[model samples]
Target: MVCVPIALIVVVVLIDVLAPPHIHLGPLLVAAPAITASFAGPRLTGLVAALAVAAQALIAVLRDRDELFSANHQAQIAALVLVGASLVVFCVVRERHARELSQVRYVSETAQRVVLRPLPHRIGPLRVASLYLAAEAEAQIGGDLYAVARTGHGTRLIVGDVRGKGMTAVGDAALLLGAFRGAAHRQADLVELVTYLDGSVCWDLAEPGETDRSGETFITATVLDIPDDDDRVDMIDCGHPPPILVRGGRARVINAYQAAPPLGLGDLARPRYHVDSFGFEAGDLLLLYTDGITEARDSAGAFYPLAERIDGWTEDDPAAFLHRLRRDLLDHVGGHMGDDAAMIAIGRAPASRP
Candidate 1:
């Protein structure tokens, strides 16, 4: 960038020195300051402007040594100086704005880390990898959330999506994650774990001044329990997308026969959360994701066909499968999604003996 301004100054000088006298190449010197405004700050721009002024004076002297300060050259010198000063001011403003933007991005990333802690690679007998893509790039974390914990009975995990966006949604996601982490160790079963989370979220929004949002706020989550020695995975779906089971080079969605209403609206219909069981054999992989993955759309308004894509990837390693899925999803949506997305891939370790 600095080179651009310097080069412009050099070319303008050459033209002024070598070109025909009637061509009047002095005006072109302003290009130095103008180009510097794009990439350099006030100090650098001012330096370029000074050089331009000096070059103009030199040209004036070269043209008529006795008339260097005469009226004819004075007007041109004043114009060049005015334009350079204006460009210096513009550079100052641009640099200030850039610094402010950088600071804002730093704060946003810090908040994201606080809300969404990193997922571990190994949990109990399963090898795990997770991914999150926020719809709003400025907001590193949105409504999507996932967490895993090793409990006394087994390894418990939850993948959830809050109802809204912005800080409110982030707060709700944090609340649910915190509740799950605390309750997973104490609750003996999946049902109890989910019940604790539901009650906590329900009560959180019902607080004195928070009731205004209570009517609309809710979270859709899927809770899972993988026992240490069992060959099955248990799930409790609360108005969320179903998990997918991959085994023996085939893929299938594990839909729940019964699902309760999403938490925070349990007062509307107090149905019991059913625990759905599925066979998780050796070398099997389980995929849990939020709606952002399935609901992603292309220009033609077609939804992402996740199951069809996964069918061919059933035999791929868990890490490779997720990598392909993420790339394919981005391509399906033309590289921009309108909602926050998250996915967790859990592969049962084959070496473990029951």
Candidate 2:
């Protein structure tokens, strides 16, 4: 690190000596600090800028020629002015970086509050637990999404896999959720709710290159509606992975027939959407996840065993179960996921007297 700073100062001094005096070296002071913050952070950037300005001032003092300015006093003033301007530029760049970071953090926090509500250590007569991970840090939030809404019709929930990743995927995800939340609050039928989400996603992708699935890029989703009255639940699967249901001390993966070819891939002439039904017994658990979990790989090129892990996760409290699963996943891949990973587990309250 010390060698790097010394090397940088050497280069700057060489440029200052070789370049014409009027070459306008403002970029060094104006851009360097802001760029540095991303790599070395704010404090180191400040130190670097201060050191650079001091070096420039020293150069000016050592090589002063009194021909153009015609007076030693005027030359000294010029040197001080240039140094002050450089300092001001560095300070302004630092301030701009701080403001930009503050805004990003604010938006990230707000997105979490609105789009990804914290799982209630418990949810509506059930113990709810979840885990979410984003592969790319640039997107703290990714394309995969899920939400649980208690409504007039039932406690409606849905988990979806958007066609792409990154910002475009996030945009599509926001559209789908906005529709789901709106329809769940108003529409009583599970069929209409899924239809609403499907139509909304298709309409939003009406623009060019939106529906173009680059490589089977389509939104796969499963919508579930568990009525408050009983343990029965109805689901709509659109090519997404079947959620695993653990019950009676045994774990079984719940797979419904392919009702549709996922959202955003449907044509006007295609067959209609079909809703599938299932029953959630008391004391049973359901786990929903995107492809990321099943696709995670170890360096030796082995797929992560999500199903095996879920089997082992049985009988533990929701939190501890999720914790164990998360640790095993990290150990499998050496602490990183290549894509976004999302898991939601909802368990019915323990057995009640008839």
Candidate 3:
């Protein structure tokens, strides 16, 4: 690739020198540095630009020794040099921006790993897989979050979406995840764990300056506790989208009978957190996701029908199922999403005997 630009310079110089005197191809030399800027750093681009300028100067001398100092030739040389200089400047600016963007991406990925750690492929008796899609083009993680924790009796999980996007939403997500990880093990009951999370969110959002947003800011989440030896999973829904259960090639939403308010608004709603128990058999697969998945719109403004799409998908492998769903969802949204989406697939494996 680098040689192509250098060869271009050589070809242009030779052709301009060998062509008729009336024909001037010196202007084409500017393309050499322009091409170099696309794939090379500032130093290399500058070198290519200098070589192009030198080649232009050579063309002037070879084309006409007497007219070397003439206005026409001087202008041509000056134009080539100016264009090359401009291209070099452009390369410098581009490289600096590229470096800054790389740094930002590194920091974003590190922060995401800390705040939204990936779930293990296997947790106790369940095979789990998770996916997260950030709405922002340059962001790796946003308002959508999921985390899993192992307790003495069962495996606990939480999937939540913050009220908004951007840094504020990220902070809120981190807060909720931290709270869940810290208290999921200590709290004996699913309701107790959710209560602790709600209190944490309420306290954080109620801080002095945050009073204005305290009422409006809330996290919609669903917390689950799947006992290692039981076929039923206990759940507490906090105004989040219901999970989907796929059994015998049929998919259905596991709606919460008694839903509670979102985390931050628990005080206003004064809601009672109800623990809903659902059968999660060995061959059953449960999917928890954020609203972004259900709310995604295609070009025709039609929402993606997730339940219908996955109704007959009997892929028992949690990872493969989520991979197919991710591709389908992206295709449905025309390859761009307006909001962050997250999904977690938990499949109970066949029990093992001692």
Candidate 4:
């Protein structure tokens, strides 16, 4: 690719030298450095520009040796140098912006890893797989988050989405995740763990001068506890989408009978959190996701049919299942999402083990 611009310069020089002197193809030489700036750095682009200026000088000498210092030749050479120099300047600015963007991306990725650590492929007796899709064009992660923590008796997991998007939502998400990780193991049950998270969110939002919309900001989350010794999973829903249970080639939504208000709204709602138990037998797969997944719309203004699409998907491996779901969801939304989305698939492995 680097040779392409070099060869272009050589070809243009040859054509200009061989053509009638009146044609004056010297102006075409500017293309060489312009092409170089697209793919090469400032130094290389500057080098190419220098070569182009040299070629222009050669053309002038070839056209008329005695008239080398004539006004026409000097103006032509000056124009070529100016254009080439401008291209080199463009390359320098472009490279600097590229470096800055790379640094920003690195920091964003590191923060995402810390706030929403990847779920282990295997957690105790369960096979887990998770996916996060950020709607922000410049961001790789957003307000949607999921995390897993192992306790003495079971594994606790939380999948949540903050009320808004952007940095504010991300801060709220980080706060909730940190709170969950800090108290998930110590808390006696799912209800207590969720209460702690609610309190943490409330405290964070209640901070003065945080935001004008603090009153409207809240997080919808589903907290789950799956004991290693039991076939049942305990859940506490806080105004989140109900998880789907896939068992024996059938999928059904596990709606909570007594749902509570979203976190951060506990003070206003005066809600009572209740622990809901559901059968999560061996070979069962549970999917928890944010509303972004289901609310995504296509060009025709139709929302993605998540449940209908995965109704009979018999893929037992959690990773492969989520992969298929991700592809399908992206296709349904025409490869662009309007909001952040997150999904987690947890499968209970068979009891018989080595």
Using all chains and alpha carbons, the TM-scores for the candidates as numbered come to 0.81, 0.66, 0.86, 0.83
For each candidate, the alpha-carbon lDDT, in order, equals: 0.84, 0.69, 0.89, 0.87
Tens-place lDDT per residue, model 1, 1-354, is 788878887787777778787777888888888888777789999999998898889888877688888987898899989998998888888889878867765775677678778887887778888888767444444678888889765799899999977778888998999998888988877887888888998889888877476659999999999987788889999999999988876889999999988988776677698999999876888899999999999899999999888885755467777898899999999999877899998888876455
Clashing pairs in 1: none
Tens digit of lDDT per residue, candidate 4, span 165-267?
5667778899998898899999987877888888888888778887755559999989999999999999999999999999877899999999999999877
Top candidate when judged by TM-score against the true structure? 3
Candidate 1: regions farther than 4 A off: 56-86, 134-136, 269-271, 292-305, 314-316, 326-340, 351-354
Ranking of predictions according to lDDT: 3, 4, 1, 2
Model 3, span 205-288: residue lDDT tens: 778876478688889999999999989999999999999999988999999999999898978888889999989999999999
Each model's number of backbone clashes? 0, 0, 0, 0
Q: Rank the candidates by TM-score, best first.
A: 3, 4, 1, 2
- Error (Å) of candidate 1 at residue 178 is 1.4
